[model samples]
Target: MQEDVLIEKIKKGHKQALRLVIEKYKHTVYQVVFGVLRDEKEAEDVAQETFIKMVDALPSYQQKGFKTWLSRIAFRTALDAKRKKQRQREALTEYAPSKEASKSAEDEWLQEEKSRAVTASIAKMPETYKGVVYAYYIEGKSYAAIASEHRLEEKTIEMRLYRARKWMKQHWKEDDF
Candidate 1:
């Protein structure tokens, strides 16, 4: 019956009519998105997303100003895309440590967890094993050094550390480390 408007044609069947709508408004959509995004590739991408959004929103659209409504969709879609890009960029940009590299939150957390687990596990050892395990593993002392510190023979230090390892293997889960 020729409502004779682009939006009217689009609302009726929407396949080929949507194509006409896009062809008519593509430049406006691109400009609206580009005004906010300032990147040609991203603007183009957002313009496409904006069209899909417009078609989805067309059912809810009363016959108000079509161009204003369409531009608003383009603007909002661009901003949403921009915010998403910023978050992704922020996520990717981090972890590129500077020359004076420092530990990341994840690394620091894992180190602390490992240290605590080892210390707590060692604390559960018998008195005879506790000193040797702490000195050999936590303090990074050699068998001879631990023996000298404890005034025991080197073989005694080795035996105690071996026994401590066996105890830990039995008592702790495989993933404790």
Candidate 2:
């Protein structure tokens, strides 16, 4: 069957058209996903999802280069899956303690209390002031990057950082920090 005919059948909700679609493009889609995810099993899964999404979106298919469209779906699906996997892995690492687990609860409580006090101090700052401060210091964003991301002038970011530091010095304690 011609690719266009198969796509038309898919748009008409012919279930068997999905098989032909998958058979024709599975390897191409799988290669795109695997290039990003570097995992064969995950690539296979994303390839399947790409075909499913393509089938569901068939009505919108413009008969443009179908391979290009399918490859884009595969790439995006792989990227999304990679992000989810990364988040899960990061969560595990964030909760795992290399040494902190050996410390007493009182030690951890003291740390938490200090963090809370500093947070309260930060909360007292003006909203516009806090955003730049967090972006530059807490998030470690460069002035140029922060300016671009927030659509602010670089000098404005610098000024906010200066004020936020001064406010921190006046209101926050070293012990609490």
Candidate 3:
């Protein structure tokens, strides 16, 4: 079967073929973004972006190493999104916090504060280490899948996750969790 056949069908808006393509590439795209963003929700967002780009560019997609090309696009898009988010966060952090806040022993407020603190700690972690933790724990991605997506050995992914968890434990108390 010619590659263009699938491409043409997809470009012409054939839902079945489009769905097939999505199924084929969805995990790959999700793994790529998850390896970078270290957040399941953010990875899902980037995966959607990847699919959108694939659909929009389908008509002009070249036949050379299609999967690699798709992977490259997914990788770049995720990194760009991460950089943009980091910049926005830094800008927001520049704002001074209010000094006088009401005391709150309420469960909702305590929970919210704890969530914020955990998020902050995760954000502080080095990107590579954080990626492993998010992929394994939060995304519930397997070590083997992560290793394959990243072209690394499974042991490496395991070690990264192990160290990341240790770092989190050392830096954050159980109460913070």
Name the candidate that leads on lDDT: 1
Q: Write the per-residue lDDT of candidate 2 for residues 1-177, one digit (tens) a residue.
A: 888998888777788987887888888998999999998888888888888787777778799999999899889888999999999999999888878667899989987887677567667788987778767766788999999999989998888888878877887677656
Clashes of each: 0, 0, 0
Candidate 3 wrongly placed segments (more than 4 Å): 1-3, 97-177
Report the Cα RMSD per candidate.
14.3, 13.4, 18.1
Give the per-residue lDDT digits (tens) of candidate 1, residues 1-177: 222376777778767777877888899999999999999998998999999898789889988778899999999999999999999899877856664368788888998999998899889889999999888778888988888888999988888888888888888897878
Q: In model 2, which runs have C-alpha deviations exceeding 4 angstroms?
A: 103-177
TM-score of each: 0.52, 0.55, 0.52
Model 3 lDDT per residue over 11-32, tens place: 8888887777778788998999
Cα lDDT over the full model 3: 0.82
Error of 3 at 104 (Å): 20
lDDT agreement with native, every candidate: 0.86, 0.84, 0.82
Which residue pairs does candidate 1 place in steric collision?
none
For model 3, which pairs clash?
A: none
Residue 13 of model 2, lDDT score:
79
lDDT of candidate 1 vs native?
0.86
By descending lDDT, how would the candidates be arranged?
1, 2, 3
Collision count of model 1: 0
Better of 1 and 2 by TM-score: 2
